[model samples]
Target: MTTYAIAHLHQTELCAEIVEYLEKIDGTLAPFGGRFIIHGGRVEQLEGKFRGNLIVIEFDDRERARTWYRSPAYQAILPLRTRHASGDVFFIDQVAQPHRATDILEGIRVPTAGVAP
Candidate 1:
């Protein structure tokens, strides 16, 4: 299954370190087949407030995504972005096709009758 590395970066500093990080990040991702699906483009907000930039990188699978994140190349430059930006970063697996909105309910362990959840 495809996996994504998503980040919501706020209060980013456009400094020399950040510029260097941007230049070198692609090289780190290439070996892992990771590519940017979204790179902080303009937003067309239709709901609640949003600020800062959103970045999404796609990987072939969860293993590849995890390996890339832990690889020395990515780890080397990790501090560059961390030092200049504040935000959230996480990995998420893509849902399978022919899916329903409630498919996630299957993973929930519903409380048994008369038992506390």
Candidate 2:
């Protein structure tokens, strides 16, 4: 199944060390098939607390997401992110299509929310 990972970073505060730590994580993520669809930017909140950055990453599978997160490189820089900000990193496997239950969901990219279709 295709897995999607959303790494949310709510930076209640930031410091020099935290910026450096995110850099380290960036380097580690490069090797894996990781790409950030969302990063820190200006936006008007439509609902509840919108405090910080939201990072959405697309991975091949749950295993791949887990591997990137648990790998030594990420582990090494994990502390930096923790020290700098309040965040959450999670992966969710999208339900496969009825006709393609045996296949992966990566083939079908779900439309993002807040779109006028």
Candidate 3:
């Protein structure tokens, strides 16, 4: 399954630190099969409220996404981000295929045979 690193920054300060973070983040991702899908693009609020920038990175799986975030390479430069902005960071695994609401509901209707059925 694919995973995404979703970063929603609420406050940001443009400075040399951000510059360095941008410059080096790609290099850190290359080794872990991670790539930027969205990098500070213009965000249009359709329904609710949102602030600052949204960065989405795709990785091979949840483990790789976690590893990339915790790796020494990324950890070393994390302070730069923390120093400039603050927001939510998390990983979400993507569904392998599109499914209807009923299909998803059926998936949770019964427990597994061995576990709790």
Candidate 4:
């Protein structure tokens, strides 16, 4: 299954170290078949609080995602991110096919013959 690395970054210090980190991150991820799907684009918050940048990365599988994060190459540059920004990162497995609301609630015995509320 495909895996994803999602991050909600906050409070960036944007320095030379961060620049170095940015320059090297792609090289580090390439070995694990990791690539950025989203990196620093305009964000519109629909709910709750959001700050700083948002990043999403895709990998071949859960193990690949975990391996990339825990690899020595990434470890070497982790401090740059920690020093420059604070955020949350998570790995999630993708569902084979995303469900519609009714499809997701099928277990609840909601009739799918018509629109469900």
**Predicted model with the maximum lDDT:** 1
lDDT of 2 by residue, 1-117 (tens): 778778677764677777787667667777778766676768789998877787777777788888888899988887877776787778887676675654656678766799855
Off by over 4 Å in 2: 95-117
lDDT for each residue of candidate 3 in 9-116, tens digit (9 for 90 to 100): 999999999999989999999999999899888787899888888899999898999898999999999999899999999898887577665665664666678896
For residues 54-112, write the lDDT of model 4, one tens digit per residue: 89999999999999999999999989888888888899887767656566565676556
Which of candidates 1 and 4 is the stronger one according to lDDT?
A: 1
The TM-scores of all predictions, comma-separated, are 0.89, 0.69, 0.85, 0.82
- Which candidate's TM-score is highest? 1
lDDT of 3 at 48: 84
User: Candidate 3, after superposition: displacement of residue 44 in Å?
Assistant: 2.3
Which model is ahead, 2 or 4, in terms of TM-score?
A: 4
For model 3, the superposed segments whose C-alpha errors exceed 4 Å read: 107-117
Where does model 1 exceed 4 Å of error? 107-117
CA lDDT, candidate 4, residue 15: 98
What's the distance in Å from true for residue 7, model 2?
2.5
User: How large an RMSD does model 2 have?
Assistant: 8.9
RMSD of each: 3.0, 8.9, 5.5, 4.2
